[model samples]
Target: MSTSVVENLGPTVQNVPVTEATAAPSALDTGLTLGAVVQTEGTTFTLWAPAAERVELALIADDGSQRNMDLAHTGEFWTGFVPGVGHGQRYGYRVHGPFDPAHGLRFNPSKLLLDPYARAVDGTLDYSSPLIYDSSDGDSAGHVPVGVVVAGSEPPPPISRPVHWGETVIYELHTKGFTKLHPDVPEHQRGTYAGLAHPSVIGYLVDLGITSAELLPIHHFLTEPSIAARGLPNYWGYNSLGYFAPHAPYSSSGSRGEQVAEFKAMVAAFHAAGIEVILDVVYNHTAEGGFDGPTLSFRGIDNRAYYRLGHGGTMYDVTGTGNSVNTAHPQVRRLMMDSLRYWVEEMGVDGFRFDLAVTLIRNERHEVDTVDHPFLAEVAADPVLGRVKLISEPWDIGPFGYQVGNFGTPWSEWNGKFRDSVRDVWRNSSDGVKDLAYRLSGSSDLYGDDGRYPYASINFVTAHDGFTLRDLVSYDHKHNEANHEDNRDGTDDNRSWNCGVEGETDDPAVIALRKRQMANLMSTLILSTGVPMLTAGDECGRTQHGNNNAYCQDSEISWFDWSLPDAWSDHLGLTRRLLALRAAHPVLRQWHYFSGEPVVEGGRKDLSWIAPHGGEMTEADWYDGNLRTLGMFLAGDALRATDAVGNALTDSSFLLALNATAETRQVVVPDASWAPAYEVVLDTSNSMVTEVEAGATVPLAPRCLVLLRAL
Candidate 1:
């Protein structure tokens, strides 16, 4: 997700001497590293622009006085070392080359280009700046923001993710939205990186029982021209500019160089709390959108090498956000890889969730290929990054891009099937039982054949791009008029049910139904056999007033409401209970796909599907479109685990009975042979404790799920 507010353009960077800046590494190493490197004697600025004839570094002083230094060419890299022009120096590149837009060579010496590897960007982009576009006839000297040179520091010691994939509970949250409404965070620190690491915020996440904070994009991003023109912001932050630099706007420190340190401290804090920090990275496209877009870093540096060019030198818009980053190119691919490693090694981030990841694996011909994709193979084989969690969105807006089950091993995919199937089943749609079964079983049909474990599927019911859980059951259609696109921006395939009324209602019965449905969705996500991701504020009934696509609604409509009424206490409590139960039970989260075969001699198999009438699901029952109530029996004897000593782990068998119809249903329990006695462990109907016997029929409330344990 993007940030909404436009950060005001700040003062320019002040020059610092080599004595004040950090000393560079004296050990002979690969000099291929890009960006400005500070040294004890001098600072060396490097730029990789094979297409440019000459690249000049423009150093803007404290008084806005500019000095140009001609860079010496070493192979494809243009390098220049200037004594005393060390850290905190405001700088940008001026490339003089052919400016033929039709052939995609958009190099204009008039527009100062940002360093692609800038470690700290000082100011925000002004889209209205005429010089932002090379096609325009002016220079963009004082209008655009400049990159700051920073003396690199030692990276913090790695503290890898502590939780196993099977036990991972991802919480997707926007950095600003998470802390902007926090009651305890200091006002000055709110909505910043420092605020996110606040003790109160950490305490809430710990209490919510999530392993990783899959934060929205925090990279140096730019506000789009269209979004800025409408006086709206791209709060989602998908439009990234600098991959290596953390978005300075999120930093509370006024010093330009301190953003990197603040980001590292935030990651260190999360690591200390045993919470992994997984960045939502967007490498699919740069902020420099279509051909008509601005002459930012990539477009001005080497448009042909950085972006995929179509017929007549047009951009190959696979991501639907203008142009796709040409990962097929070796230099571009290396830039992405280097950025990922830098976050893990330098910033101490534990993992990454790639946005529109399909674009990264797509071939030069715009075809998705995992087999021979060099980038994919390199990431999966890298020593440092390979150990960290790697999650892919697995698709883009391109043709044949809906590759749900196409990702190779060692990479988990966000399970869109789980979201759709769960929504359909809870909405009581036709033939949803089979679909729900597939999802609850960890979508084995998608990951099983590849020899991947259940953890390969990251299951979830709601995420940032869709309606929040509160709105999912409160609206039948997307209410995104607030997005200001005539309600035509977001997707319309929301399989939601509004209970009895659309939007908010004072009707007690409708409110109750909505609560129950939300509870059902939460319970399913927590109990499903995969890595579950809980959207932030879902546990507390956070809402966007039915605005499913609030990507641009950056006001209170997108921020988390900390003032939830006492009526939502049950909802929060229910989510906590479900998560605790999921953690306590090994059967609920299996590492391996259920074999449906005996684990021990003369014992029942690990899993069994039961019809409402108590028998194993038959062919007719599986095909029944009207079927709403079903039971899943997980034999605890077959559920296996290992302790530190590698001893076998055991737990009580569980029987999950689900009823999605709008009326009470009599769900018959399995025979005594399956379990001589049973006790209801969880009831979404009232979050109450009750017991039932084997072979007995129990009245289950509509849109409720009951978890029973074999006694």
Candidate 2:
């Protein structure tokens, strides 16, 4: 889509007027004027300069032609209506003011400044001593009145498509890691935004049934000083440099505005395919690390205002990324809120998953407060952002960091317990059946009340942070040797089992067992009563060569191999079938916690656990570590949807039997009042099941799961 086409697709839902600023007395009216040239109504511009002694809009043409349009100063805001200057126009503000840093004024008339609301920036930020704050000379350095002209242009391409929340299933992925080795993406477009938007990439996502792709941090970021010296780039892109600009490295076209266009095109294509786009935002910290770091946007703008400091002007490392942003500050909070609103309104993004969100909620006293935090409360209440799918990493590396269930209602979290518990139950040890039951039932122990539903807890067996599903079942330990960290990095407590073999093997038995284990993990994840997140490439059995911390290895160690053998194809097919089953069954995706009560009058409970002997589970049976044979009976009539008067809506029933023991056990089908005969729908012991006679016991294979539907 062209920029003009995007501009014509106007009036998004997030374009609400700035109500808070309009309701209050103008701060610019009482203070020195600051200039702003806002483009609205296509080809028309409005300029604002509060304390400018004189303001002029100098349009710099491509051939070095210049035209000075004198701006009109209204009540604090300079207004103008320029026709010829539309998209792709390069301009800057020339304002005359005192240049002082100690008293917080660095407005140089000679130094042309880019518009703060510029949708797209045009030039690269060349690192030089000129961009630093110097206090060497009296007036030229300390409060320098030097001409520092940095190249910039009008805001980038406008966002055309904005999908709603209810229709979003966010798939968080790293841009570079996603397409670094994508076979179909061209060599030039391989790690760029264009690559992610390619038909091949989008086709995979469409098949996966995910509605939104939540990309990891894409803001222009800097490699850490320590990491830079070792010649390592920040692969995660968590440390942001420019909020408005797209990361230059991910742009295949290399044009200043092309990145914006490409990113928008990606969103538009996804929207066209009925999918949303979410960004994993990092506002907790910046690339400007601690006291001794580069002075980027926020730090250069106002160090004390933007960052939390310790006693005697030291830096407080709350996010473990050095300087923690002082989101408690009013202006700092405005910066973050404005950034979020900008993405939602102008970038066509549907939602955001905040990284280190707890840091943003920290108050001025350096204490994390969910209630009093203005920024958090503002986002939760803001009409433009309130309805957006707001997810939180929900923790930081600070004191009392793990805030899993702390985020208030209308917010979902990455359930770490779900990841660990599921992994432990299937891959670590089979002793935690009771713990696995809690996770499978939507983790009510963590988020049961406050109107939060099961979807609020995003359950997953594996994520980008750790081992892939294939690796989890194949490697007993993390292989971080490729990271050059001497295998010191990555978590040691992976709770993974090698299944009697380490890494890849030619042993057919081991390979077969691993594939079955992968199926089991995927089955549990999709069948669970919460939103399941499947890591990219997990369906095709992607492996990171046993490297859990492959964040630095941008080569094959992280790239997903789409090419698979027939066995792998079968596993992928099974994964797809499991996901389809989950989508088809209302009993599997219950919004509320399983009440364990019957919906039908005088019928069986909605769910009933059974022992190998076909009797209802007793306390002793549930607690027995050796007793791994378990069965669950789900009543279709009992799980029916109700009207205002609580009546049945749909009829479906099934039974799931799981045998985690080393020895095969007989799973007796109970002749209950609700279900008299059960038909085999899925049997992991064999490739397919034809039929099983009613009341005829079936021998469940060791470490196998079987599903049956009532006939």
Model 1 Cα shift for residue 438 (angstroms): 1.2
What digit string (tens of lDDT, one per residue) describes model 2 on residues 586-699? 777777667888766877788888677777888888887766677777776677455458765555787887776667787676765547677776666674255555565778
| Model 1: per-residue Cα lDDT over 1-711, one tens digit each | 111111212222233322221443221123467888898977878788877887778887777667776676555667767788777888888887887778988878878789998888876677777768877757677767778898878775555547789889999999988899788999988988999999989888888788899999999888889888988999989999989988888889854789888888888788888899999999999998898888878998899999999988899998988899999888898789889998988888888999999999988888899788988888888998877899999999998889887797889999999999999989988474988898888899999998798999999899999899999999988888777788888888889889979999999999988888898999999988999999888898999988888888778999988877255788888888888888888889889889889887887889999998999999999888889888999988886677779987777899998999988888788989999878888888964347777888778887899889999
Cand. 2 Cα-lDDT: 0.67
Please list the C-alpha lDDT of all candidates, in the order they appear.
0.84, 0.67
Q: What lDDT score is found at residue 23 in candidate 1? A: 43
Report the error of model 1 at residue 355, Å: 0.5
Best by lDDT: 1
**Per-residue lDDT value at 225 in model 1:** 91
TM-score of 2: 0.81
Clashing pairs for predicted structure model 1, backbone only: 1-236, 1-237, 2-235, 2-236, 2-237, 3-235
